[model samples]
Target: MKHLSDEQLVFHHYQVSDDGHSVEAHLAGCEACRARYQALQDVLSAIPVTPVPERSADYGRQVWQRLQPRLDECVVPFWRRLFERPSLPSLPRWWLAPAMTALVLAAFLVGLFWSRSRAQDTLASRLRQELRQELVADFQSALNRSQERSSNALAALEARLANDSKAEARQLVQALHDMLGRARAEDRQMLLAMFRNWEEDNAAAYVTLRQDLEELASLTDKEMRRARSILVELAAQTPPPDPPFRINK
Candidate 1:
């Protein structure tokens, strides 16, 4: 025979099943069904039952009173307020068309002004960049020209020095004087100091050479030949160039 289902057992336990008598007869005959029903009753009975706290008659009123301030502070959004229709004076129906046209015109004017200002700013920036590039190019060109002139002047000075003639020496002195006249005060002072040092070294070399030449006649043939070779080597050596002049801004 089929045993009573858990649903039938539960309904029978609660005294709600329509066939409670038949379920009870089945449980009495089947030991397995009776054991299952007992287990279900034990599980339900193991659960803890809680009692609800009693409230006073004015509980709802007290809750509503506590929440009323917060509700009053609730801010309705702008869009919702618009939908609720705020109390403002109504405009004439015919004025709407002209007002819309004016709004569109204002927006167009603002956009046009902004675009023009941006264009002007861009143009100004481009012009400034171009001006800076031109200035740099001009500065580089001037620097190159100055370097070229200085090189040429040094080459001429070297050529003059190579000549052993008194005329060449006079020309060199004249050229230096001309340069000193054109130079700034600080450059003139530096050039003068360099010239003084060079003059002292040259004077000393000249005195030494003169003494060696005078003593050559008293020396033996082999010693004279050695002295002549030494003199030739000294004459063959080139003098060092003067410091290059630079203009400081």
Candidate 2:
């Protein structure tokens, strides 16, 4: 006789069972078919309804007799007969179904969100680094640029101080010497124009000069202080900028 197909073995395993001789033969001789049958059995077993209550042999005969009238009436179609017992085959598949569901849920969450794993840093530590880098860089760049502008400005101040009618004034002479060679020409001319207009009509450049002066003053006091105070403790012993160049006749 021809051997049974897996589908036949599966249906037999679930809705019905083959005899012990066929089961043992399949297990001993055909491992593949036997494994498939066992898998089908596991899946089917997972969705177990209340086991049909054991009754006397008359019970099956009674069910057959009741169904025979319905069969004759053709009240239920063939497909409906196929599903007199509900089956959720996709759900209870030998542990694989649960695993597949979990895998899909995990993939969806991962697709929706990219969790930033900062095993590289602790919470406060990461915050500190981010703040330090951002604030320090901003402060440092602004400090350097303002200092550059100040160097140019201090130079012009010295030049004018040196040229004062009272050239021998102690504070003026000292400041002139201290500020020698620092102010750039462009900056000096700019400052001169500012001062000249400040002299004329005094209020002519009020709004324009007021805003400029405020910004410059803020750089000098607020921003520069914030930037410089950060470094004061780090190198308190170090001397200030050395002045090596001298250009005067």
Candidate 3:
């Protein structure tokens, strides 16, 4: 079984514990906790209670009356004592009208001067504001014009560059076409020269073969047989001819 703490017992004694029933059940079952709780109750009961004194209905008035003599001994301010004394001479009634008129005139003059100064200041401020606004407007107008001019210049430059590029491209294409036409003409001339050389070589080879055949035909039988054996030996010793050269269209 769990024992109750002193704080729990104190809360239970004051009936301030949220789990009052559980504390009570624990105290009933636990002998040590119950004895501690009983000692706490005895100690609290033994402490003396101090009673508050009651005040009468006229207490505030009685306090004021008791302090009146001491308050009276305090020094009065010089300005208040001077006004309270009866020995000072009073001013005459005849001078009051002129004094009042002079005071009113002075106040009116001061007010007029202040009003004029304020008017000048306001006008100066308004002029400054208008000048600033005009300066800003002029600056903005100049800036917009400058930006527009720059934009137009940039556009013109881009257009010029584009035209130049197109012209250059056309020239390059024409140059390439002329170069290809020249190359094809050179190739045709080279092919025609090779064909002419091949025809001349074929004619020479035909003339030599005809001479050899006529000499073989004019020989005796025995000489022909000897010549045929020598030819067979030469044919056997010679390298084979290369294949014909051909060109694709």
Candidate 4:
């Protein structure tokens, strides 16, 4: 025997099929089919239907009017939708581009500032070095010129002293020659007496000359000592040159 299908039984239960009599007759005659239909009816009847809440007649229209903007918003542009979607790291999709651009720009600015600072430092250091080199060269040149001046002054002083000494010696020789010629022209007896007197005066004069020479020698020694002290002081007062700069690299 062919059993009625579940579709026919459901249709018979709901009275939806055109041929309901045949499924009803099968359910009434066949115990298995009858039991199945009873079980289905019992299960369905056991489930309670929830009652829907009642509202005013304009409620649907009002709700649709309120939600229309949101539904319209749902039809977002493709670009906006793409940006609104989130990806990895829990970051918002909209914030990614601006954040990346800001980060890249910040990094570029930092690198630019650092490079500029380094270049400024290098330029300042070079300027300082050049200034120092120029000062050193100037000081050395001044020192050389000073040494040359001192040498020339010392040479001139020595030459002047030599000329003065020669002039003094020549004057003394001329005066002595005049005195000797006058003595030779005088009488022998008178010359002898004059020589005796001259010897006595010469001895006295020689003693005075010896004392004057000693005093002049002392004065010369003091002058030489004073000049040496002045030279030492000048050398001490001179400033030293700056040390050269060194680079580790």
Give the number of the best model, judged by lDDT. Answer: 3
Global Cα lDDT for candidate 3: 0.92
Which is the winner by TM-score between candidate 1 and candidate 2? 1
The best-first sequence of candidates by lDDT reads 3, 1, 4, 2
Put down candidate 3 lDDT per residue, 216-237, tens digits, no spaces.
Answer: 7777666878989999999999
- lDDT per residue as tens, model 4, 1-249: 788777777777667988888887777789998888888778767888788889999999999999999789667688886778564545568998999999999999999999999999999999999999999999999999999999999999999989799888999999999998887767677978999999999999999999999999999999999999999998899887667876778
Better of 2 and 3 by TM-score: 3
Q: lDDT tens string, model 2, 8-125?
A: 7765665466465666676668767767777877887798588777799798899999999867875668888887986554544589988989999998887655443343346768
TM-score of each: 0.32, 0.21, 0.30, 0.32
Better of 1 and 4 by lDDT: 1
In model 4, which range of ten residues has the least summed lDDT? Answer: 83-92
Q: Which ten residues in a row have the lowest lDDT in candidate 2?
A: 112-121
Q: Tell me, what's the RMSD of every candidate?
A: 36.6, 41.7, 25.8, 45.9
TM-score of 2: 0.21
User: Residue-wise lDDT of candidate 1 within 90-207, one digit each (tens)?
Assistant: 5689999999999999999999999999999999999999999999999999999999999999999888767756787898999999888777777878999999999999999999
lDDT of each: 0.89, 0.77, 0.92, 0.89
- Write out the backbone clash pairs for model 3: none
Better of 2 and 4 by lDDT: 4
Clashes of 3: 0
